[model samples]
Target: MTYTVNCSILLTELPLLERPAAAKAAGFDAVEFWWPFAEAVPADRDVDAFVNAVRDAGVQLSGLNFFAGDMPAGDRGLVSWVGRESEFKANIAVVAAIGERLGTRAFNALYGNRLEGSSPEAQAELAVENLSAAAQGIAEIGGTVLLEPVSGTPAYPLKTAADALAVIARAKDAGAENIKLLADFYHLAVNGDDVRAVIEDHAKDFGHIQIADNPGRGAPGTGALPLGEWITRSRELGYDGYIGLEYKAPQAEAFTWAIRPVAG
Candidate 1:
């Protein structure tokens, strides 16, 4: 199976700008990332540095997330956030520019967590608008906007494949055909979704797939979540795309699962 390493989660030991080279040295031809900047519209020089890093390292930018507000501080995304529509719209240009520069086509847009005062219905409506805008912006680069079900955050509404797919359908109804689902196995399992059933029912609906084992969200073998079977099932059901390695662990042991043969 082919894979792309998620530099944002795996190579934590290296400086942000250096993870691409580290990923290349580790034998991956492609790497992906969350928004790799503090602000939505980062300074031009920072964008240049990120683009140049991937170029110099000779790896493809397989996928990227549009700015998800302050991830470390618990801001999941801006798409549904009541007041930050401008920031998300602003980041689209930046994301499109970077995707064009690095040949990336898949873009993950994390659905925002539910805010206290914001009505869920309103947030959901706003999400479609933001996601539609994102789809249009990335379309110039032949890009597809990805919606994913995130686990662990109680306020996060998209906790199952059905939930995200419904949103994608709504976005498509609004004329953003480039929008699709990002099937992250770890998150689905943790959220109590039957992943195999999801694959069986909606394989072609996936635009991308990210994998990390449960328990600690580590490499595949670190937990017994049947990730291999899910992966094999995903392929058998027709998910012919890069399986993103978005696991967490120290650099010394993060890829231990890859060293062993994958199970079918």
Candidate 2:
């Protein structure tokens, strides 16, 4: 029942190095983020400084994503993309090193969007290969590789918990045992999937869970989804992992609802 802030979305008003402190000030002892550097492999000094920021802020680095291209420019991931395999492979060691340094055990690897000319079978094969490699590298530090189902993009293949699990299965079959699903409720609800059913059937399959109300991707109370109930159900079903707050809120006051008791 612990909570972690996804610094990638929240606290954008502060500098990248300062977001961890901002999260701590907002009462979060742990934080997660997408790749903070523009480059896949940044300078050693940059990496050291980032690690220092989290340590100095007294917040634990709970999760981190491998570089997935320019996220703001509509690049979801490169691992499965045909020509980007080299880039994707090059990032594995860097991500593993960072995870070890930060004591982060959860790593998310986005399945890239489908390419225009590539066949689905080709992309699927590549995804399995790259994911297997990622899982192998992360496993060295006793970390798990997370596969997420993102919403609102048809080109992105994994749009449901089942979809992500299937990919995890493929990776495991390929000899990578550390793969697990990252059940992000906002994406599932936004994609029009039954969020509760996913929780009921696959709560035990999830390694991590993230939440943001649907429709607007805002704080829990700002949307009509039964977030409190869903969270309560997840706990009832024995999901003791962190529930990451990965929403966009205009101000800090939007999180007041997080302090409320869970509905029965």
Candidate 3:
């Protein structure tokens, strides 16, 4: 049972480059992050710095998200943002490069939110095209591209596992089988999905998993999500991917319940 800490959210107290080392010092052998750069295609120096940080810290980059646009500015993803198709495609080589260097084979592609003037149908069609391209690009490194179901944003469309899974099916049917589900338990639960049934019937479709307690999105036991129980059950049901600690809490106290996560 390997747990990967999300340095992006957990170790925000430190500089972005320092978080990996912090996770390593916190007894985690693996780490994951949202798209680390501000742009889809960042400068080579920036890319080199990011790749070197993970390597120098001696922790595996368990997963990385594709450029999801200005996250702090409220942009969720670029996979379907009308005319930004090239930006998403351009970001692929950089993602592949980092994966090749750091042995990362799981990549998250956050689906973009709906635009005011664009038809949902148009955005969805573009999503399939971009995802198909992304899957092919990551496939060169034997990586699986992940489609996640997010919560807290009404405009964000994929709020359930089934929603994300359907998009994955469309992308696969478009000829890229490397696309899979990111099964973030926090989002699934927040979106009011039947989390247990999601796992019971579709654990086989999970390419990765992330966790955070509900109500506050805090550490385990801080809320009423029964996160550890769900994670343990996921393992029993055959999801063997790395479990991501993608919660918000005091860095010093976040991993207090990080010991193999067997609910009791």
Candidate 4:
């Protein structure tokens, strides 16, 4: 029930190396970021340098992102370049190397949007197929990929936690164990009919959890939802992994809350 900070909140100002240092300064044990490496760093700026920064900062990397878009509904490389399979596989391989460098083993693989005229079932199958390939590549590098389900607002159609879990289970049945759920509380509260029950019911399938209050998408204490209470309750139910700080920081004051882990 310990917490980790997600580095996406700081991508605007800090260099990649400084992000981990900032998280440590904020009292976090670890930090996470969206895709850290797009190309082999310049001959000047290399992956080892980035990895060393985290070590020097004394923080663990919570997770890394498997890029699915450049911007809102921007080109999702997964389905668009379906024919050029090698490129898609290469994106996943780069993510694995980044994860290894950061001391993290999970990456959030976005399920692509529904294509025009495509059946819902067909879209789900395509998602499964794509993630299966990505998961296999990550597993080879000792990493896991968590499929993040968006309600199609910022990203389309596979918009529910249950929907994502179904595809994840389907992929597992097809012999891929590296695929699991990346549960974002903000997304769930936005789309899910019953949020708390959903978390309780599917805790086992969840590989990681991200939290932000609904509506504002700000820190846990800044929104209308009782996210701090939710975190407390979740720990009571045996969730002992990192709950990522995935929301934007509030302007006036920093949001801080204690996470009390429930003893077994």
| lDDT of candidates 1 onward, in order | 0.91, 0.88, 0.90, 0.68
TM-score of 4: 0.83
Minimal lDDT window, size 10, model 1: 255-264
Of the two candidates 2 and 3, the one with more favorable lDDT, higher being better, is 3
* Model 2 ranges with Cα > 4 A deviation: 260-264
Error of 1 at 226 (Å): 1.2
Specify the poorest-scoring 10-residue window by lDDT in model 2: 255-264
Write the residue-wise lDDT of candidate 1 on 1-264 in tens digits.
788999999899999999998888877888999999999999999999999999998899999998999898888999899899998999999999999989999999989999999999999899999999999999998999999999988989999999999898899999999998899999999999999899998877789989998799989888879988887888888889999999899998877667533222
| Residue pair clashes in candidate 3 | none
> What shift in Å separates residue 30 of candidate 1 from its native position after superposition?
0.6
Q: Please identify model 4 stretches exceeding 4 Å from their true place.
A: 37-46, 72-84, 117-122, 151-155, 250-264
* Candidate 4 local lDDT, 203-231, one digit each (tens): 65678888887677877766777677766
Compute the lDDT for candidate 3: 0.90
| Cand. 2 TM to true fold | 0.96
User: Least accurate stretch of 10 residues (summed lDDT) in model 3?
Assistant: 255-264
Candidate 3 local lDDT, 1-264, one digit each (tens): 688999889989899999998888888889999999999999999989999999999899999999999888889999889988889999999999999999999999999999999999999999999999999998899999999999988889999999998899999899989998998899999999999999998887789999999888998788899887888888898888898989998877878876743222
Error of 2 at 19 (Å): 0.4
For candidate 1, report its TM-score. 0.97
Model 2, 162-236: lDDT tens per residue? 888888898899999998889899999998788999999988778899999867999988889898898898888
